[model samples]
Target chain A: MGDSNVTRRSGKNQLLDLYLTFAKIGATTIGGGYAMLPVLQDEIVTKRGWATESEIMDYYAIGQCTPGIIAVNTSTFIGYRKAGILGGVLATLGFVTPSIIIITIIAFFLQNFAEYPVVQHAFNGIRACVCVLILDAVLKLGKKALTDYRCVLIFVAVLAAALFTPLSPVLFVILAGVAGVILMPRKKPEKTGDEKASDAGGKEGTS
Target chain B: MILLRLFWEFFKTGLFAVGGGLATLPFLYDMSARTGWFTTEEIADLLAVSESTPGAIGINMSTYAGVHTFGVIGGIIATLGLICPSIIVIIIISNVLKKFQDSKLVQKIFYGLRPASLGLIGAAGLGVAKIALLKTDVFQESGVLAQLFDWKCIILAVCIFFVYRKLKHSPIFYILAAAAVGIIFKL
Candidate 1:
């Protein structure tokens, strides 16, 4: 109980650190979630050692299927790993602080900025690079996620739906989860007959 | 009363708009129908603003929409609503289902999810590409190949693609460079 209390006390400081770090990321990143990935890799993997690059990709995948902004969800997950529930709240709040302020300010004062030609031209250019950045994410994720034909098939089918049909991504994700359950097979324990070996393997064996 | 309605509306939006920011568009459309808070055209405008802003489009849109209907406080409440589900869901997964991470069932779910995730990302990318590369509506209206492309953005995209292949920079650098190109071309 004393140890748990000590951990919680120090966790408050780390929670603040998480808030500031995510605040910077939230303020700086543009063009949305995929654009945030490279920044996240820099902050989470290289800077903080909070997660691995592959781990970031994994969080992103889970974040996508989960509700809410993938970027904020990812921030919450990272913060939770570091400091528990309060950390998650701080991280999410930090990540969104700049956005809420910016949008609210814009909503009240600068709603007409979109009509400006300079802004229009700027957005037109920005949109293309956003696409490029997103493609970069696809490439990086492809290296990690696309290990087999089954993976490829799922990707292709989902891509077609995204481009052609206005399908809810939630529906597609649910369907994918179901597909996963049906298509993926269990890796049978090899030492099923030997109880002692099975015991050892059950404790530690992994792919 | 307005705040409660705003919170409930965005709460539902955040709970179900899976995939990411753009995924919320359909839900927002449904919202327009039910509450008459904003029109489809306004939502489109909000999307542009959300996309260009330095955060998740999902949060930005909800905040903007909230502000439109109520005020700054409404913006806060609505954003809270949208993000509440993510916090709840993620906290549950982290605290309880952490064990399931290693299980076969979880592994299988991920296997299926990875590909679908890719598809969603790819489609989002394709949507951006279409907006940047093609003049689909113009082509639809004119039915002519000659009037069917935004050649300037296309050339710029191709060049940027190659440069991005050889080098990497912060996202801001590319956004600024693209903005410069836009200004130069008076796009």
Candidate 2:
């Protein structure tokens, strides 16, 4: 829908634009997810007019809900909307290019120096910060995820299972999806019984 | 063969790690536990590096793990493996379902997935806590209660946590500051 300007431009130029824009965003943003959002909005929405703000939010929503890294997912969605499959692939490649280059260099050096006393000491501190950052993420995510008691129940159950059992996290994700579909509609019926009931029943029948 | 395994593992990670970059931690921990490709401590190191660095945290971590395991080429393979799912899924959604985000079924599945992913992340946080806050090896060897905790790390973690909560600086700032503290105190 927003490809009018893109159509006027040559395919090669548009693709290069998509790749370079995302590569710049990827290189500049320090943290992923929300941190990347403002920069993404600036470059893709404000600067380039590739997508509207609302559309970017939609992309983010889907990006969060679906699998894979959110930044890459959003980049792909925007790129696809801008051009096509080639656009999507190029954008994703552009997004991760900086990461590959930077991390490969760091990993190359870190591996060699990893055993050194000073590097080890620095890593010890960094590890503590990792714990802190993860703790912050859990709190933020928990606020969003644990909305009701059902969600709280799932959270506790999954946490217990994760710690104690040998079950794969992949299994947990799938099971939780099933559980959500089964559990959520029951809550909806309290507000509008007939409509939701039939809707759920119809969906269940189709599947 | 190792590279293939790395690809497959990260592919699955990309496929199932719902929510965001941090969600990949549990899968990485599982990968280490199963394959011994790297240690939990290494994950912590990589996490720090990933957080401070540019680009997506998931891509950075995967690249780091791949490089740590197999070399630079391994990093490339693991990264490609991780993004393959996103490419396929996003393209399908873009071509097929314009209203996929508004679908009730999609919302329902995520309703369940969100908390479950949180639990997985919480468990991963505990894993990092173990590596960051405790000295299991010293405890195992000495069998002393006092030896169980690395008090300095515990103090460092507590201080960093509180300081972070109060200051609200970017994660990189705190991480870099903590590294300075570590070097100064030889933690």
On TM-score, the candidate that comes out on top is 1
The number of clashing residue pairs in each candidate reads: 0, 0
Q: Which candidate is the best by lDDT?
A: 1
Q: Which stretches of candidate 2 lie over 4 Å from their true place?
A: A1-95, A106-111, A185-207, B1-82, B93-98
Candidate 1 per-residue lDDT, tens place, B14-105, comes to 88878788878999999999999999999989988887778888989999999999989989999999999999888887765587765767
Residue B33, candidate 1: Cα error in Å is 5.7
lDDT of 1 by residue, A95-129 (tens): 99999999999999998867788877888887777
lDDT of each: 0.79, 0.78
lDDT of 2 by residue, B58-110 (tens): 99999999998899999999999999999999999877656664567766766
**What DockQ does each listed candidate score?**
0.55, 0.42
Task: State the displacement of the C-alpha of residue B18, model 2, in Å, after optimal TM-score superposition.
Answer: 11
Candidates' TM-scores? Answer: 0.82, 0.62
